[model samples]
Target: MTAPRFLQIHWLASYPGTLINRDDSGLAKRLPFGDAVRTRISSQCLKRHWRTVEDDWALNQIGPEMAVRSREVPEYRVLPALEAEGVATDEIRKAVVLALAQALYGDKAEDVSKRQALLLGEPEIRYLISKVSEIAAAAADAKSAGEAVKTAFKEEKANLSSMRKNGVLEAGLESALFGRMVTSDRAANTDAAIHVAHALTVHAEQGESDYFTVVDDLARDAGESGAGGIFDTELTAGLFYGYVVVDLALLKSNLGGDGALAGKVCEHLVHLIATVSPGAKKGGTAPYAFAEALVVEAGSRQPRTLANAFRQPTAARSEAAAAALAAHLSSVDEAYGAHEKRHHLSLQPIEVPNSSRIGLDGLGKFASAMASA
Candidate 1:
């Protein structure tokens, strides 16, 4: 039988004496969930780490490098290409600012809105440059050339949906999986296939202010008692709970109905989610760690989080958290009936109801096969 329509993954990872995520105040991010304030990591931070990693399971390795998100595409890419083609400077800028701007960015004549960093696929970029060059080469003068570009862009805008459907520009792998929002055009927008929750510690945040001094070697040798520099940083240690839900159908649809690629992504993504840690102060804290406990479930039932498992704020120990999760799952199963298939992997080998005990490799492959099925 084919796998269910959704996959939900829950994990517990520990980062001791490390600030996995920090707020604008440079303090560890926090969430007041269930009676305690837990140290938290934002979904944006987690996805950025996974999307940009160059390791064996890197998302970019599966396809193209990345979509270019920039406000300098005209100045850097288009203008340079046009210059090499001997297009006049005035024509190029006018097309970029007056014509191409309306087509790609907005109809506004102002420059500030066009300055926003917009995500453009490489294929789309190449097509734009080629069209702009052709328009400039054909026109009798600069003014006509600018008008031609605007006309060409209008045609391009009308074909956005078909181009995306036909895989002319999937907007890179990142956009296909995580999604992209085009404020001006709904046709250009791709809905997110993977939904991630902000990860937070189950217990109260274990935080500390670490103060240290960097002494000058010469000053110390010269018998000076004062330190060269003094600084302090916040550090926290706790077992964090992370949850992610993958819409299998949406993933395939976003990838242009490529089911095999979708399966591969789910597999690699499972590994990435379990093994990858948010890299913050790695040199000092060495915060790298694997999930201490993982529970992956597949079902069509409306997805739910087990966050309430720790409503009383369990201890930070892996065993304690794992036990609490197991008990909660058992209670949930008894109350609602077990309808989904589940797989569990834990450092302590705790019981997770309706789940098969599996190793990391086996779990990834199983999830992949299920997604493909």
Candidate 2:
């Protein structure tokens, strides 16, 4: 196997008076790491934000290359295509639903329900529609078309290899990065190429409870007794550290060796990580913040995370945490000589005592280098 190319990204972001990620108990998620309790944001939350950003980017930049994750494929994709082809309104729903079931479930198609959602891309939709149309064209009537569809898929079930070989189920970039699993059909599964670590605070600090009251304007104007509402919420303030790694070789394969698409994916991912904020309490606290410091590393060495730098925790501010992380990384590189290239971008004016700094302008260049690798 060829050595895999990897891109490692680390960032330090500070939020004030915010519950960036909450637990089931409605408290900010916290974890006991190293010597102190650190605020934690789950990888699931981060990936959700990343996927949302990627989907928007794909729609605006790439034009319909992103997949839709839904269970209503029969209604949204199949029915629409058949309708456009002049299939009768009444016959379209039953025919397409039956065709989809057979195409996806084979002999067990009857057990499959139309309500089950699946992660499908446009390519897969088009392929299914083509097969259904072929069966429809060959049939003498609607009833015959339905039977022909079932028979065709039953034969396909007998020869699973031929079915898979002819299936044009192309995974989109988001699916390629995060992956998908079809319980009904294992062949549709895509292995994820990107790994994200749960973000943790760089310092240990106790969270604060904000007790405030909201008054109904009409009640207050009408001279109602007492306050309209009173409530309390838990929030924390600290410098959070995030880490992510991308397997370039796997990403390339996921994009079907399309170098250009891979480049776009890398670029958008980097941009989102640097600027996007996964505000957990979006409407209430509105903790919209971006990374204060970002480091991107690309190399052939085994990927490493800087989470250990926070084992002892740092000062409350981001600058101290950023410097500590930079120092720790430098020590590791000196001892192991691992990284091939490292680049830094700081939103604020801060200096790492022992590392070279790259301006934000170099992000595009770094992303290009990562994609080409």
Candidate 3:
């Protein structure tokens, strides 16, 4: 039997890095599946651009300015509540700090009716904006990321379903099948990818062998220490998880073929993810290593082209400009698809033992402690 066609995905920006101060509109940048610099859209970027948090402790009040005058607001109320409960003043203050953070970043929904009216005054833009907001709001409401995606699909079933059925169609407003063009802001996208590219290049320039092992070690360190605050590792991990789900949702809705196409999609995703990491070396053996391996297993020597430029941004739809890229993405997609064997090196799930203090100790006591707790 053929291996299951689940998407093997990793967030392109899940690895940690210091956020460089730049006067750029895009959040992050990285190299594309091919050799081109493309904007990196991380889970952090998506969440920051959208997502709302619900703060249970914060007082749901009037406007912020009006909230300042109220003694019941978090800045005042939480502290007294803790103090009265005999909590230390310093501890109360720190808890309050966390509370404020929750107020801003937690998954609470705000009444956007008034603001929506003001910003999206035009009916057409308002409709699209409303749909987009609905997608974000529903995703935020669900407890798990998967639930959030389910919520999003439930809300926008018709549109997303259509996109899945038809690969990607661009036409006039009335004739257009998929109205939401993700790449409309081509310049912005390129700029974003460039930032990710610069960071990756800097890492590559340092010169290293054992690229995968070295990067994985760094990723592990960053994750354990929470040094990946800029990248927001956990959330990014969840977001990439959602992206795969979204892809599958599309495939299912489209009612696409389930044979070799399934295997190909899985292979492409795995290879794409391996190379998308922060420190994937650009030269020598690593260049098309994963793709080459996949092609060899599939027993095809197809000459694939990719949209790769020498570390710079380009116009998306420019006929002459996009030709190289369009060719590349096509071949890359196909070459990955042709692989026959199960791509074992794709993704290995890391099991986290359930214990107060994790690792080997957590392994044996996990069940017992959970039962007792």
Candidate 4:
């Protein structure tokens, strides 16, 4: 088995809202990023507010699925089959987990099954399903059904702790929110990966218009559509901050020794970013607000890596990153303060009306400050 790889974390900061005007039929509205106009995408005008909850659900659901999908089998399809057999959902859940564990984890399935049995003792149905998983795997391998069942029970009973411990390693950070059992086996996991890919694609298409609308509405409000092209599209600096733990060991185990799979994943990542970002030029100086620099750190904070924890900062590495963040924020704060004094404009955050669809008006405060400077 390949050793675990360091987890990578980053963020994608977004501006949210939908573009109102349509230029032509069947065509998405275009907007500017730096100097050139590109297509606009959006999630919702209230996108920022939704980010808090959406990430929680999306990450939890997607993480485990991604891990299991590494081994492609029809694991998810087994859930209803177990239910049809009168097996309890709890057992069915466990059984499918074991099946996945056996397929992806190989010899490790036995111990993993036992640990799950104990943790979910009351969920008899789920546990039963889990038992079935082992049975199915053994059967698939040409073992007698009775022998497979026997081996599953024996392994589960004998090496319960081993199962639990391995669960921690296999799950990494996901264990915290979803518990350390094979929630979805390899097949189910593979299905989940496909689902995540689709969801991300949908998000990107929706998000483009959101950014465009925010900028355009603001521009129109300020009447900055001057012939001088003050509101004309131009390349603007953008950034991405994301955090995800890529399970290299899991990837290798599922994808075989094909090292290209990892690179393929990276390429797909770039594609996803471009798809989501509206301002991305068709290969010019227009840069998408996705990833720029790549840095991976070793440490398990789970759902969130050490970098995310650094947002608040407690540990040494975290503190270092935090210090940098604080310094940057401070510089921006100082600049804003100077502008407020010189322009005599209120620096206070004010609520703007929702219906007055004007983008230019929003920058009024900033424009005043700039003139004064």
lDDT of all predictions: 0.81, 0.73, 0.26, 0.32
Which one is best on TM-score?
Answer: 1
Give the C-alpha lDDT of model 1. 0.81
Candidate 2 CA-lDDT value = 0.73
RMSD of 4: 19.9
Q: Supply candidate 4's per-residue lDDT for 321.
A: 34
CA displacement after TM-score superposition, residue 314 of candidate 1 (Å): 0.7
Query: What does candidate 2's lDDT look like per residue over 85-119, in tens digits?
Result: 86544464466567666566444555545345566
| Poorest stretch of ten by lDDT in candidate 4 | 193-202
Q: lDDT by residue for model 1 over 15-52, one digit each (tens)?
A: 89998899998999999988999999999999989987
Better of 2 and 4 by TM-score: 2
What residue runs in model 1 are displaced by over 4 Å at the alpha carbon? Answer: 80-103, 106-116, 139-148, 154-156, 217-225
Per residue, candidate 3 scores C-alpha lDDT tens digits across 1-373 of 2322222221212222322111253233343433343334343443221112123211121111111112123333444444454533443343333433232223331222211111001222223333333333333332332343334434544432233233221111111101122221221110110011122221111111221212345867667543333322111110111122212323322223333332332333333333332222223222221111111111123222221321344332223222333344345556565332211111222211110222222221221221112
Clashing pairs in 2: 71-117
Q: lDDT of model 4 at residue 310?
A: 26
Worst 10 residues of 1 by lDDT: 159-168
